[model samples]
Target: MKVILLERIGKHGHIGDEVSVKDGFARNFLLPTGRALRATEANRKRFERDKDDIEKRNQERREAAAGIASGLNGKTVVIIRQAGETGQLYGSVSSRDVADALIAEGFSVSRSQVDLANPIKNVGVHAVPLHLHAEVAVSINVNVARSEDEAARQAAGEDLTAINYDDEANEAFAAEQQAATADLDTSEE
Candidate 1:
């Protein structure tokens, strides 16, 4: 269907411009939303007067988006998670987590802007892309670290299996060590 756009659409056309679009889209969305109207000789003439204003607004929006893109470039975000011995995260990191991390780092980003295929299930550094605008995208670094529990076990000479069984063994060893120390103290006394 031929329609006269009443509003500027993203990277497509400006208000008062005649464009061809699918009939269903024009009827269900554009026409109902007052974004466009059926193209007629009367509407076409009316659009000519408003075309300059629409172009100006579109230019301003593009410039503003470009400025935001510069600030978002090359930013890094870290996600700390509990990981097992095989480097698999105990809980996956979702796009929401990345968005929150960006916000924490003083970046205003939406979850929908994050271009993650799925939840991250492994621990490492990753480059995550954020699609801010249609032409404006930025790559941010994500450093996934092991949680404190995992780190502590690693520092204590333990892996997942070792730590699982070490709980009971550690208690027994502690008791024996304490008893030996007590005997030494008694001898000294």
Candidate 2:
């Protein structure tokens, strides 16, 4: 289907350009959302009449999206979830969780706007992208950990997985036993 785009679509076409797209795309998204118009003669005439106003609106929307993008970019949101000793979360972090966290931080974002393809299933920092506009996107860090201390360590670039608590406990026990043996020797002397 050939349609006139009302705004710039990334790598697709610019505003006021007539481009060919899939029928399903036009029917399901573009036409229904009013982001595009059918390329019929009458609709083309109508588009010519409203072209200027549409361009102005598109520009305003782009500017607004840019402002929001600036605020969202490079920001991190920490999410604490219970995980086992292996750093695998018992429950995963979904897009809704990220959206809620963003809202908590005073950003008005929807779950659909978060471009996470799947739920996060591990304890680590992830870069999640927010689609502020069709042409504008920004990424923020999402730190997922079992506890606040682990989250803090992750933010500080620490590898929590590399720290073996069992090994540390064994070393402490050995040191205590050796100290006891030394005290026993001193008493015997």
Candidate 3:
């Protein structure tokens, strides 16, 4: 369907710009939300009449989004979750969880704004993208850990995810050390 956008809706189109979008999207979202109108002659004329006002509003919104992005970009959010010794979380951290964490830190964010391709299921630091506007997106650090101490270590640049302790490796290293010590003692005697 062809429509004239009243506002910026992601990558679809800018305010007062005529663009084609999915029929379902036009019927269900754009038309109902007053963000767009069908590209008929009358609606086009109406859009042209209100074009300046619509563009002004869109510019204001974009500027606000850019300001928010400037403060949020390069910031890290710590998330504590339960996990086994291997650092695999018992439950996953979804975008909603990240948004809530951000809100707790006094930032205005919504779950839909978090651009997580998939939920985080492991304990470590991850770079998550946040789309504040069509042209403004920022990557924020998400530190997932089992405890406060672990979270601190992760934030301090420690990678515990790759450290897997094996019982056999520990036993072999201990036996080798004992043998070397015994050999030294026997030679001294």
Candidate 4:
């Protein structure tokens, strides 16, 4: 189905551009979201008549998004979750969780704006993109960790996923082996 876009959609046609999309996509998402209208003769004429108004609204939205993006870009949000020793989270972190964390940090954000391709499954810092507007995009850091201290360590560039053995234990084992070697030598003598 062909539709006249009211605003610039990612990879779709710009404002007032007629483009063909899937029928269900047009009916369920584009039309319901008011991002587009069906490309009928009557709708085309109406779009032309009100094109200026639509562009003005789009510009205002873009400007507002730009303002917010300036403040939100590169900001970090901390998320606490339980994880195993290898740093794999018990449960993954979804976009909703990131959005909620941003909201709690006094930012106006929604799950739809978060562009996380997949749920986060590891304990570390992740760069999550956000589509604030059609043209206004920004990224933020999500510090996922088992505790506040772990988050801080991740922020400080520590990789917690690696299996780290205690240095003291290694030293103690080496000392025990040397003593056993000496005992064996004395018995042979």
Q: What are the lDDT scores of the predictions, listed in order?
A: 0.76, 0.90, 0.91, 0.95
Q: What lDDT tens digits, residue by residue, belong to model 3 across residues 127-158?
A: 99998876689999999998899999999999
Task: Give the number of the best model, judged by lDDT.
Answer: 4
TM-score for candidate 3? 0.87
Clashes of 4: 0
What's the residue-level lDDT of 83 in candidate 3? 89
Tens digits of per-residue lDDT, candidate 2, 79-135, equal 999988888899999999999999999898889889999999998999999987887
> Cα RMSD (Å) between model 4 and the true structure?
2.4
**Where does candidate 3 stray beyond 4 Å?**
166-175, 180-189
Say which candidate scores most in TM-score. Answer: 4
Residue-by-residue lDDT tens digits, candidate 4, 19-78: 999999899999999999999999999999999999999999999999989999999999
For candidate 3, the 10 contiguous residues with the lowest summed lDDT are 159-168
Clash-forming residue pairs, model 3: none
lDDT of 1 at 66: 72
Model 4 clash pairs are: none
Of the two candidates 1 and 3, the one with more favorable lDDT, higher being better, is 3
Candidates in order, TM-scores: namely 0.55, 0.83, 0.87, 0.91
RMSD list, candidates in order:
9.6, 3.4, 2.4, 2.4
What is the lDDT, from 0 to 100, of the residue 91 in candidate 1? Answer: 91
